[model samples]
Target: LHNMRTIQHLPREKQMQKATETMELYAPLAHRFGLFSIKSELEDLCFKVIDPNSYKFIARKLREKKEAREAFIEEFMDPIDEELGKQGFTFEMKGRPKHIYSIFRKMQRQQKPFEEIYDLFAIRIILEEPHTKEDCWRVYSIITDWYTPIPKRFRDFISVPKANGYQSLHTTVITKKGRKVEVQIRTRHMDDIAEKGVAAHWKYKEGKEGGSETLEKFVHWVRDVLDNPRPDAATEFVKDFQLNLYQDEIYVFTPDGELRTLPQGATPIDFAFDIHSEIGERAIAAKVNGKMAPLRQKLDIGDQVEIITGNKINLNPDWINDVVTHKAKSRIRQYIKQKERQKAEEGREIWEKRAKRANIEISEQDLTRIAQKLKFDSTQDLFYDIGKGSFDVNELYDVVKQFTSKGRIDDKEDEDKPAPVTEEEIQETYINAARSISDDKALVINGELTNVKYSYANCCNPIPGDDVMGFISRTGDVKVHRSNCKNIHHLIQTDGERIVDVSWAKNIDSKFLGAVKVIGEDRVGMINDITDVLSKSLETNMKSINVSSDSGMFEGILTVYVDDIDHLGRIINKLQKVGGVKSVFRYE
Candidate 1:
């Protein structure tokens, strides 16, 4: 009933509402089905009522200048028509102009004014008796032979149709009068297929609809995205699915010249996965046009892509960040999860190795308890971190060494390490054990003070995993400095006796503070932009920020937690990339 109201042409407001429905719902549906022509038309129709002035002006001008437009079309068609006629090729010609919405969209994307936009019109040619692949190439030859074709503007969609199964031979040429225009050539069947898309298949008498399972799967996916109950959910899904749907497809061959369709930005990874899931899982690298290319390389039309596979597992977790397609991302994530599971099993082996190396006897149950204390959901997640370089292996060794080295365990008695009698005794004992009595300021490591001790240094606060050294004060208190700190060498030289060995504690939960200074052009919303960059873009929790502006420059000092130097670098790099940010550097 609602669909019928949309087509019945009711009141102006009703028409507007219907168009909106089409834009929000059907346009995306069309895109999901790879029906670019339908999607574009729906967008154009919605824009007509949404912005009536632009629509009216564009339509009125095109019609008001109808004779001129048709004359131009006639001229555009004359040479191609004459050439095809000489070659005894039968075809029909049609002129098409840019709709208002498409022009507006182009204007918005290019950030250009309308007057600068040319080629707001195009022409299409439909050839007959071009059912075979050879016939399509023959048509291509006939068209190129007659006209001075623009190499960049030519598109051979007949061989590689748009995602929606639309096919054509598209080219652009400059007329004798020097007016630039686009020309699209296709067969009558191809034109019909272009217009109605999958619906066009329904129009055919043959069983075209049941022929390809891939096509049926694509259509079903499109309907699923559209039929989702929540409007917002449908809208979100469409945005992702639409990119794949509306893009012009490339027909690339395998090494054996078998054709495959990939979207414009599709890399070799996309191509590999399209071929087979296992093949994609094993893909290590790719060859494009018979030369090695990065997996992220943009594939051109008719460019062959060959994926290189390896027997050894080598899936990079970072591949998840680069893939544009959901399929590729999902597959990479699956591989990462599998790798993580394997790592979790390996973490046990690693822990056992550490125990043997230190001549200590500990079981997996003890590691599990420690892992739970650290709030890890699984021993695998913890071990995966150890395997993936997120967790330091040496720190695990040091921590285990410290705890096990001077244990008062009675070697003759094995009672599974009895628990403390009370919670307070556990806390008190933990605190006393954390601090050394002889130094009263040093934290003992492996039963020795080692030369390093722990105290929060005034210069560049250090964390558990931070590379650091201890500076012993005159009062016998330890002061820790980052190992790279410039003040450390001078302090050690002056007070060598005060220097001690220090390492990050294994189970430390203390937060270390760091600051970033952002300098940018002072403008309205500048502060908001900076705050958004920190909070939203960088995902840093801003405890306190102080901003000062002078001479068209904005400076902000942000205090945020530092997991380590790498985390700090990631935040700084993100801030540096923000618009209008002149510089983002560590303040202190």
Candidate 2:
């Protein structure tokens, strides 16, 4: 369907859109299935329709040189054909013409012109399967004996077939005429698999029409993408579908020396996830080639990766950035969202308990009122903010106080009663207050201090690593702020005694939301590239991405989850390297 040229009869706009989809979708699918002939044809047809001038120019060049190229191929094959027959092998030799898209890609990649392109065609040797390996090597020996083989251009796929089951012995040798010609040696069975891909494998396997369980896994993976419920369903499906299409597999080894196959760019985190969800969740670090490496370190063809798991299951949100596989990404996202939902629930409980202690009944009506007072779009948002320490609990109490006076009277009576509170009593009160809400500590200082209800200041967005101080508010809750925040001076001068020392708990592994601004020259696909870079970093989720372009310049604001300032810095540095990106800075 992609290779069809009849779409030209349709309207130009429709033709171009359909052509783009075919190239982005069908071409990669063909490549993944090892349908190289079809893949090349699809690419050429799409390229012709997409960029007719370049296609015509390259086609014309090939046409002008067709006769001489065929003659040269015959000259290159005759001696080898005779020698192979003399060596007691039954083989068929044929000329393989290079596809126009393949030539165009080479020119684009090498930054060369059409006239400088060499090896416009190849020679294929198909042999009987009974003695396939021996005969293929025998043919290789004959060819090398006749011509000088390029050491770097040799590939022995027979010993290591590709992930798509493509097996061929490929070599590029210099002929007597001092011109390069590629040679492919394979059996008839291998040729069938190479052309028909999964279909041929199913036919030969004598299994169900679909294929083996292994092949079914691949089919199911595709179905998973198509079934993924996303807002931009088609676009996301195509993006993920194409992502899996052109991958070259890399085989890595586990600690037990068991071979594990992963996509070429997969990292240790991906490897851990492939092993098991538990292993991936507990993976704290990894050692590649017996040396400590970052989780994002790319694995090579045969590197041995040893995952170091922690006792507690604490996955960094950033692992999504380093992982390339759909499974890893999906699992990580699921885990993070689950944690977020749990946190939101915890926050809801905190609100309910606080309201109860304040002698206020938090009915649905009260929640709606409080949400409106806090400018929250919904009660869930209000709870999430309270849970994430983004909302000041004192303000919430103040708003809810207006709805009832039952808890206010108890507080007033307690205040009026002169009670001598001892140090031990105060400590017990704090512990009881902390225990009433959640086991998770609300605030941790130099020591494990609890019962300190605090909300993060929006002015500084103080994360765990930041130098922070807490300010006691009217309702006894604390409002945390960065020590160096601009608003801290007024607080320091006016209420220095209320400032409390605070630090993140040693075991706190939660993520904090941060905002960043990216400035770059405006160009097509710039936003996609920028988001791709972000997606490959640690636990970085683009909560929102707003891009504005003017006068060929683009500026984007991205709000994402980050572990700390250091995590944000790593993300910024990565964004800086994206094409056309001029600068990346944290938005205060």
Measured by TM-score, the strongest candidate is 2
Clashing pairs in 2: 317-539, 318-538, 318-539, 321-536, 321-537
lDDT of 1 at 57: 53
**lDDT value, candidate 1, whole model:** 0.64
Model 2: residue 66 alpha-carbon error in angstroms = 0.9
lDDT of each: 0.64, 0.74
lDDT of each residue in 1-588, candidate 1, tens digit only:
245235446533244445555665677666655466766777776666444545665677667767887887886678777877787877777887776677776655754434446677878777766444456577667666756678988777665555556667777877666778887767777777776666665555355423254356456545432343333344344554555545555667898898876666777887886787677778889999999998777787678888999996656788765655545655676666677778867776776677688687755675555565455766677788886667766666665555566543323443467764663454334334335324323354323543233467777676555545565554444577765455764554344434444555544555568877777888898778767876787677777889898998877788887666567778888877777877775564
- Backbone collision count in every prediction? 7, 5
Shift of residue 304 alpha carbon in model 1, Å? 3.9
Q: Runs in model 1 with CA error above 4 Å?
A: 1-25, 32-37, 49-53, 78-90, 110-112, 128-147, 202-239, 289-298, 311-313, 334-588
For each candidate, what TM-score against the reference?
0.50, 0.59
Candidate 2, 405: how far from true, in Å?
21
lDDT per residue (tens digit) for residues 143-257 in model 2: 8999999999998878767767677999999977789989999988778878888677776565532236536655654554445444433544456557667777888999999
Total backbone clashes of model 2? 5
Candidate 2 ranges beyond 4 A from true positions:
2-5, 206-238, 344-386, 390-588
